[model samples]
Target: MRYGSVCSGIEAASKAWEPIGWKPAWFSEIEPFPSAVLAQHWPEVSNLGDMTKIADAVRAGDVEAPDVLVGGTPCQAFSIAGLREGLSDDRGQLTLSYVELANAIDAKRRERGETEAIIVWENVPGVLSSKDNAFGCFLAGLAGESSELQPAGGKWTHAGCVSGPERVIAWRVLDAQFFGVAQQRRRVFVVASARKGFDPAEILFEQDVGSGSTEANNVGVERRSSTVDNCTLYRFRRTDSYIDDGVSSTLSARDYKDRRELVVMADNRVRTLTPLEYERLQGFPDGHTLIQYGEKLADDAPRYKAIGNSMAVPVMRWIGERIAAALPAEKLSGDYGGSKTPPDQRDLWRTPPALFASLNDEFCFQLDAAAAPHNALCRKFITADQNTLETLWADYLNVPGYVWLNPPYSDITPFVKKASAESRNQIGTVMLVPADTSVGWFREAIETASEVRFITAGRLAFINPVTGKPVSGNNKGSMLIIWHPYPRTHCHFATVERDELMTFGAKLLARREAA
Candidate 1:
């Protein structure tokens, strides 16, 4: 397949898809460093520079109408770290331009009696919940909807599919760590096709067959030096530090100078990740960003930024393969059997330490009912191996302190029923779950719980069980379901700011540590 990429930071799509017989029609990157890197590597391919002009250029036949249109438009406006001006921001406007480019490519192809180009887009998961409905607008434009599509339950899920007048669209939030990268980088990927009988879901969703081991299809699996003390200390702090086990956090474009965002502690020394390590972490070859620009060697700052901004090569490679498998003539028939299953349903999203600390202080949580050894927030906890659902909570929490439960997203009904039952037996419980008010279980919680706290500051960035890093840009809003030992006559409802809780919790933990 020949593809055109826009906002092509270092052309990660080209690098990932090239090995599988896919070719690049052209690239649209304006950054000096990344543009130079593209020229140095693939000099023959033209750099279209400004993406806003690509639609006009393609319409004028100045550029090839590729078989596929792939791009990860500027996400800052939609990123939680940014001002989040959404479509009002100039950068966020590029998302619309991307749709125009896709339409232009398909228009040119249609004139030639060819099939419509497949559209692949990637962005921070924050886009799904943008206040301006940025994702809904983009999807509407791509799907040819007469009006903007609203997410069910007023929030987008991690995965879903939609069919519209123009195209069939499927989207899912994928984590780089699952694709063989060590970083806990979670980003939303959307695939759309206008072809008749084509199901975009086939390209993005995978069947849960086999042993569920990703080893067989691991990509760019590079070996790194063992941890200095048998455990790598991954720390992220606002003013204080907390240690956790696992891989690195998401590498950001500003990570080069943002020491507090991610810190590596080894052998009693603290330091920042090197540029070369950034490249490797993104599944690029060592020194992939250390390219020759005009005369002098490229500086470390630009290299760090470029690599950090790029997508994880392995994850992109997997997507490319899936797309290829769904191409014309080679498309597989019959249901994949797992397309509708939420991709993150089984993931162990540990509660953020600061938030947990604050809640623990308020409730004196003595038992972590749903936890693994690596992500347990309390000294006393039950593991998956123990079958928390099958086992009695009274057996674990003999004393009668509050219980904290962040159950698997796959199914929260059983846990809710259990919590309600436990509460009736004089056990208090606090459960963190998606605020999906439409569900029966959610209504049940409202009726049975003493209080329901809707986390309104923002979507809580839950910690990844494997990486020990907080996965930001959570797609849905969260809420705390509190059940007191004695049921209240009426349930109290309140809104809490996650940032405030986190800050207060962090300071409390810091004072405790100092003491």
Candidate 2:
């Protein structure tokens, strides 16, 4: 298969896929050092300077539309170490340009009576929770949705799949250490295909259910140490440094000077890793970046930056092998059935009546802070048209009572912030959300909440808006976060069973109705 690559730093994809008989049609890179590296390695392929113009060129019949398109756009805007400005930053805007290029390639290929181009995109995990919802915008563009696609829960899980009218897209977070690399680099990879009966999930997710092993492969290398007077002193460093247990921390472009990991040898001497070592960590050949420029050999500064900004070779090779195997196969059966609701409305599934009845009895909720007329659990509630984020909770509740919120899962940052502010207004607030403790918004909720209760028995079966029946196969666990006006020394933690809650709630409702 021939492929076009954008933001191609040193052409890691080509290096990885070459053994699988995949060729590079062209490369899009503007950086002088990396451009030189690409030219040195693959002199026959052209290097398109800017990515913003590639889409137009393909549409105008100036460039060849390959079978696949791969890129890892600038990720600083969404990186945790950076400012986190998201799509507002000029670099972050390249992500949308990538979508445009993909569309153009697919359109051109269809004109030539060829299958649509497969797309592979890579980025830091921070893009999943960008304040501007950058990931939603990217996914919508690829899937041909009119609006941004919201995640099922308030936050995106480590992996998921979405099938739209145009394509089937799947994403997963993969760590480099698990892919034969000695560095702990976690990246998000998205694979999409417009081919009939082709499921991207089959490429990204393993179908083997019986192999439950989670241990890393043993390299069979002994630890570096020195023996003095029959006493061995193993080499080690402090946790502040990135080196620990023979694994290196993530390599970043800024590691040339700052954030570099240091190693303390058995002799008690300290030193930093060299540029050649950086290449080895990323699975690159030795001196891959050592090229002859205008006058002489390139220096170490640019080599360090180029190697640090590259994709791990071993990880890319695995993905290429999977794609190669599925490229020529017959149409597969059991394709993902499209969602029942539009991408924007999929999060509107209502809370189960029994679960709400059980919680309302204990909290005495008077206002449903986030709900529509049909799904509201309380008599007094606010609807989406009323702008719950801007509406005051006290206005909905005349007396002292709790407010219940099961907010939209697409962008929960605003809802979380609003909920925290409401808790400070002498109003009790109880929020039901996915039990995702790793996100930043969850941390904010925990800091302000008076209590947290995790549902332990099983996942909750939410009520389907269309069927009016419980929806099974819920993937994530649920939790209730409470912020009450009453003073407490510390936040209380507890667990409850779903079966018990539903059973008790049904009996209580029946007795009250008989009275």
Candidate 3:
């Protein structure tokens, strides 16, 4: 298989897929250091220079159509570390360029009567929150839907088709640690196949991929960051200030200097990760970036930047393998089936079991029932479809029962609004939601909720009601928003340590059984 990469930082994709019978066609990188690294390592392959010109090049026949196209586009514009400008930012615009290039590549191949190239993309999860629904626009573009980032520019469609969903696309937030990488890096990977009806989720969403409780592959005794600060750095945003688990927090290019999310090691004496260690964390060889690329780039900062910006090698390798396994074939438009899994094959996708229970108490009313209504812990339960907001104001207001909500993540505004209202009106409530303090609902919760308990366990593997299995992972951190009844608010807003919720679930289960 032949592949080309865009925004190719140190060519992690090449390193990953080359070992598994994949050859490099070209690399599109603008940064001098990374471009040099690519030129040095893979001298035989061409450097496509800027991504903006890739489509034009392909159309001009200057570049051959690759079998696969992979890239991790610039993420800062959408990252929390930045202003979150998203697609509006210059860097974020490159994401669209990626899509355009893929469309052009696929079209070029089709003209030659060859198989269309598969497209793989990676980005920070923050892209999901791009301004003016940019994420939705990008998805619509990938799925062969006629859409544009701006409505004023008329309809946008992928090349070569009048467009009736000609491509199959799927996306999921995947953690690198799950794919055998030690670093706890969570990224959103989107895969698109030119072969209509091919589901990318089938290749990307396998369960039980994480190394549960396993220590990261220790490179050597010298695997530590370069930061010399004596102050202990903690995970300041959601959880405590120190790393409890061996998994390193998401490795950013400026993590050593920014010190915003990460801190010095938990121990006062432990140092920051070395440049080589950063490479190791991303599943690259020890000296992958340390090599002589052109003028011998020896600076550790450049190495760190390149490594942090690249896709995790192991994660990409797994994706490549899956793609390879399903290759040498394509079905006609109507011949391909839907993306849903068959009942017989459901076991392959079921998440592993974890500790969780529905608690029944005088103060508890499970609003969103994972199971049947009556099966919930409370005397009253609300099904997912039920509008708990209107009900809370009409019937449940002034009722003393504590509200337990595990609402759907798509839109948590209504749920948060209702929960906050109930809590203000003497009804206690607790919500289990992602630990995203940047959202509007979170701010609303802070105004009313007594505590925003960042779950120390990180992502909670909520059990799937149908199969009685735990979800693979939420792909992000979770938190509990506890709001006590008014006139009893001494500690209005506080952080609950990780251990507080460890036995909390068990005790609630026992209480329900006794009641």
Candidate No. with top TM-score: 1
- Alpha-carbon shift of residue 210 in model 2 (angstroms): 6.9
User: Superposing every Cα of model 1 onto the true structure, what RMSD results?
Assistant: 27.0
Q: What does candidate 3's lDDT look like per residue over 156-209, in tens digits?
A: 222111123657766767677656655668787778886654556566655344
Off by over 4 Å in 3: 148-164, 207-240, 259-268, 293-297, 329-515
In model 2, which runs have C-alpha deviations exceeding 4 angstroms? 209-243, 329-515
lDDT of 1: 0.78
Ranking by TM-score: 1, 2, 3
lDDT of 2 by residue, 1-515 (tens): 67899999998899999899777878999999999999999997889889999999787656767888999999998887768889899898999999999998888666544578899999999999988888998899899999999987778887899988778999988877666666767899999989876779988887774331112232343322221122222222455423346567778888876745655566767567678777877888888998997799998888888988999887899888888888654231212111222344556878877788888889888999888888788999999899999998889885466898887765566777887787778788888877667666678777778899988656676776666776543434678888885654667889988788888888878877899
The local distance difference test score of each candidate is 0.78, 0.78, 0.64
- RMSD per candidate (Å) reads 27.0, 23.3, 23.5
Which of the two, 2 or 3, has more lDDT?
Answer: 2
Give the number of colliding residue pairs in candidate 3.
9
Residue 223 lDDT, candidate 2, scale 0-100: 23
Alpha carbon lDDT at 511, candidate 1: 92
